[model samples]
Target: MRIVFIPVASPLHDEKAVQELIHQYKESVKDVDSFTHLITSEEDVQSVNIRQDDVALIGVLTGGTEHLILAIAMRVRATALLPHPTQNSLPASIEAQSRLSLSGYPSVIIKEWPPEASIRSYVKSWKVVRSLKNYVFGLLGQPSPWLVYSSGHDIEKELEERLGISFKFISLDEVYHEYGLIMDDEARELAVQITSRAVDVEVPMNEVIKSVKLYLAIRKILEREGIKAFTIRCFDIIKSLDTTACLPLALLNSEGFVAGCEGDVPALLSMVILKELTGKPGFMGNIAWVENNRFLLAHCTVPLDLPTKYKLRTHFESGRGVGISGIVEERTKVTLFRVDPLTQSMRVVKGKVISGFPQSNQHCRTQLWIESSDSIKLVTEPIGNHYVLVYGDYYEELKWVAEAMDLYLL
Candidate 1:
């Protein structure tokens, strides 16, 4: 994984404590060469010529400490990791350094973080995995909206410096203009077929041709550079095409291409992770959820090659946080939970199970009365909070799908 090591350090008093943090990450990631290091510093970083063939990535640590400046100058690169709010928990000097570095880039501000230390660690690890996947990439079609920024150079620089992946830039015009010159006859035929479908759908035949050409261009570039995996910005290009073109595009997604709609970082990340885990082409989608006092999230995993069937059932509910639920169309699974009526104590009566998928219209109801002698304590547990009864198994699959898309887990 291409991890970025940014050690939070103090700007004043010339402290070396921050450097220790960097070493800690380095120690944890034994294969340090597979990572990009950014040292936070106040001064201008020094100069060190680094070849793409030698290092997997180049990142300048920018936030606190002089060490970061030296490191940044040596590597001479800028990336998203340089702008995080790591200094929030640090001492005043380090915090001030971080504030200065993030002055202009408000979007870089940290809005969300894990509540638990363990969760934070996992999330960070996931980020590294995401970065590694995006490093080596290709452009299949037109420029994605996310790439439309101040300059094309900025995107190229980000690809080169952060991921160490060189881009084979091709404009929509060139792809439409000289597609016939493409060397691979077989690939060209496929491209032509895709282009023909694109035209039938009113997708600006020229732009479709351009996208096909771009894909061809990227294949050649990746082979020459010995790079594997890539993200193509297909949103803008696709919008130009009519709705009918969606089918072929969707089919391409199934063929192991790391594609994205708008240049969504999380989508790209999820696609890469899913490919690694399932060895299949992945597309970003949301989990189906049923609202309740507590929300439950869930999703279903179906093998592409097989015909499968399953069921779902909900046995109980929890009173503390929002209860969530999920279900899949073809598989059978059930999730159950319960809350003590008097104390509102919650428990997971059941988790994941496979049987026959639960019927969507079935309603589950349990009567409770605090005044009753036997069930008084149980009935009163949830008395203070508003009560909402939801009976369904669709929430689990939806919740999992939401998480896969990096949706907020509340």
Candidate 2:
């Protein structure tokens, strides 16, 4: 990662003192790899270029340079990091950051010279946010009919503008066309492989084979269209083919592809962010039950690699096709989060797995009882129904990414 420092100062200040302070500031970061560009006047700010993957550090050398720094930030269209070493620098940084943030730009202020480790950590988070540019995610069919708040082209556009990712909408007909081309002989081998790993298989072999064929069809589409991740209107497939997409989504997510159910773009994007930020596949599920500090998340499909043991069962609601009843280890540290494009915010909460396996069959197949102090917010101040869960505490990283993306963190 490259760190470019742009130093700005006012001519009204003592020229010699300003130059000395600028020299000391440059010397402080010399041990680390960085480039210093001195902006003595307004003209110099116009020539600055902050490219992708580059951390733009704005050095506020004087109080009168707020407008100058704002101009540079607006020109680059990137987040700004203000470092205050001199007397007036801190005050100027506060003003500049306020203006930038009010205008929907991401900016942060550093009171003093930070340690190399801290700088590296922040830079790492910045790079993760930049890496998402131009990545493509496919949405198969429309969102499930009931997801009124979770479906729309405007949501996709908002995410694309903020995160630099693309969304591809694939028709159900295309998926069915590809599903028909898969030979039964080919799908049987994969079905056998998936069934062998399960602790129990309650569904029929033919159903498992049909589900495997859907997985293959989606895989073919992903490859052909250069899509890196995807989500499907899983319930719709059961009506057309008498088979569910639960098994296919599970297989895809386990293979490190960001696959989600119900064609929920926000949930899919949240999973993509989790996968990219923390090298782990997230389990996307519905918020089935919430009571005070305890809540339940249930879904038909979970990444096959997440659960220690899993069973094959028929789809819970329709009872027509394959579903997964995965057993996650108890007391596992987890993070639950959701991205809301309408509000331009992200809701994150930290929790632990109280029960990895479900005792009741009232909800979806794979269920988890999570304990979080903020779980009640899901009922009172809900962002949406679905939230993605991953097996670790990523609150800090998520916070940083949200700030860098100019998103309100809840």
Candidate 3:
């Protein structure tokens, strides 16, 4: 990644001193591949070429160049990183950043020379945000009947505007059509592969074959539609086809595709964001129980890659089709987050995996006991029933992404 530095200095300042300051600033971050160009006037701002992936660093050199800096920032239409050097640069950066924030453009001000690690983090965040533009997310069937607040045309518009992603809603009929196209021998072969990796297969061979065929169907749609991430109204399949989407969703996630259940668009969006930020699949689950500093998250499906060992079980609710009973490692650091489209906000909480229990029939198949101080917020200030969990401490990255997307972080 290239850092294209646009140095903004007022003509009132001594040119030689400004040049020296710019030289020092470049030397400080010389470890990075960066190029500097002076923006002395409005005409100079026009010469700056800030590409989509470039880290546009505004070298704030003097106090009177706020307008020039803002102009350059506006030209790129992305989050600007303003590193303030000595000689009135800090004041200028504050002014320009304030304007950018007030106008709803994201900008960050660095009062000191940032470490190389911080610079890389900033660039990663910037790239994640840029990667959202024009990306397509598929919604297989409408959101489940119970997700009233999480799905709608209004919510889609709000998401599209905030994240710059498009939503594609494919009917369940299409998925079923694709499922029917898979040959029995092909499905059986894939099912054997999946069952061979499992600690045990408690479900019937036909059910496992059905699940694998569903996975193949959805994979086909994802490839054909160029979908980056997707969610399914999975319960509909259980009712219509006497099968569940648990295994398919888990398989999709294991293949590095971001997939969610219940057609929870907000949860799906949260998973997509987490995947982009951390390059790990998120396990979307229901808030089964929450106490003061601990909680239980359960779901019928989990990313196959997340579990140390897993069993193929019947769907927890219907007890008819394939579900995953995954055992996650204890004491693993994890982050739980949810995006609320109605509020345009995100709630992130860090926790450690205490243990995983799959013996309960009352809850979903894969269950985890998590210890988090912020678990009470799940009751006091709820975003929704579903939260996406990934196995790592990605709180900082999530905060950066929320800020870049202008979503309120809780």
Candidate 4:
């Protein structure tokens, strides 16, 4: 991503002062492709060609930043203000943004870094925005009846139109048909690979093989349709096919494809971004309970690689299909986030894994007790019932992404 440093300098300021300010700005933004100046009333704003998808860094050297900000925003849709070089720099930036807003021009503001140094966050976020062009997502079957926070067609279409990610619908019947048509040997091979890691297999051999069949079928569809990420109506699969998709979803995710449960579009979309940032898929789970700084997260299945412990089990409610009982390491860093379909907003928080829940039949089999730095938002401002949890601290990347997409981060 190239950056054009638009230094708003007035003739009243000494030329030496403006040069020193530009020097500091260049040192801070040391890695970008290019830096050009648009000195106030001296350089022709109309003559500058602001390229598409570029971020303009407002170098607040002197007064009269509005004209420069407006000129940059006119051609480049996104603009930013880097960390201030001096105390007065920030106020100048804010004043410039205010005037731009008054004139109906918008600029993204990055105030403080979580420890900054990762200036690449803005570049990475812009890359995600450009990379999503023509990206396809598969939504297999309808959302579960319990997913009250899920969206309908209008919201789905709106997301597709606004986010540039195409969503395609696939039916359960088609998946079932493919499951029945897979070669017997392929299912057996997948079953062997899956059962090799289990501490104890509670599922019957036949059902285990069927889960493998579903896995192969889903993979076939994803490869054929060019679907980068997918979510399924797992409950419907359990009811109609007499087998749960837990194992297959886990395998798909571990293989680098984003697989979400309950046909949750937002959860799957969050997973897509996580995969892009972390190079790994995330876990989607219900917020079972909350207490002070700690909250409980549990799910029937997760990507096989995430857990330090794994055991096969029956689906929590039906007790007739495959599920996973897995454990995450205590004190492991994690970030949980969810996209609210209605508002197109994302709620994100960083935390550490505190402990594992006691083995029980009541909740989904896999459980994690997470302790957040600030739990007030978890209690007071939940975006939805479920959120995607992935290992590592991606707070800056998420923040930059939210900025680039114009998504509200609550």
Winner by lDDT: 2
* lDDT of every predicted structure (CA atoms): 0.33, 0.83, 0.82, 0.77
Ranking by lDDT: 2, 3, 4, 1
Per-candidate TM equals: 0.32, 0.84, 0.88, 0.87
For model 3 the TM-score comes to 0.88
Clash pairs detected, candidate 4: none
Candidate 4 Cα deviation (angstroms), residue 48: 2.9
What stretches of model 3 exceed 4 Å from their correct place? 1-4, 10-36, 50-55, 61-67, 71-81, 84-88, 95-105
**Residue 136, candidate 2: how far off, in angstroms?**
2.8
Better of 2 and 4 by lDDT: 2
Query: Against the correct fold, how does model 2 do in TM-score?
Result: 0.84
Predicted candidate 3 versus true structure: per-residue lDDT over 1-410, tens digit per residue: 34566678898989898888778766655433456578789888776666554557677778888888777777664545555556777877777888988997657875566434455565566667777775788999988889877778888898788668898889999999998899878899889988999998998899999888888989999999999688888888988888999999999998988898888888988888788888889899999998879999999999999989999999999998899999988999999999898987889999999987575789999999999999999989987899999998988777776766677998
lDDT of 4 by residue, 302-388 (tens): 899988878888888888778988877788999998877578688888999988643567999998988986666766876667789
Q: Which ten contiguous residues of candidate 3 have the minimum total lDDT?
A: 27-36
Candidate 1 residue-wise lDDT, 1-410, digit = tens: 33233343444423454455455445443333344333334332332223322222212123334344334323422222222235433233244335536543111122222212322333343444345534555544444443332124554465365445455444544433343465444444654554343212323434334444445554555456554554444333333421112222233454555544333333343455444433555423222222222222221211121112212111222111101122233222322322221221322211222222323332211111111121222233322211111123323332332232233322
Report the Cα lDDT for residue 88, model 4: 61
Query: Mind giving the per-residue lDDT tens digits that candidate 2 earns over 1-60?
Result: 455777788868887877887786666543333655677667877666555455676767
Q: Cα RMSDs of all predictions?
A: 17.1, 4.0, 3.2, 3.3
> lDDT at 43 for candidate 4?
60
**Superposed Cα deviation of residue 87, candidate 1 (Å):** 38
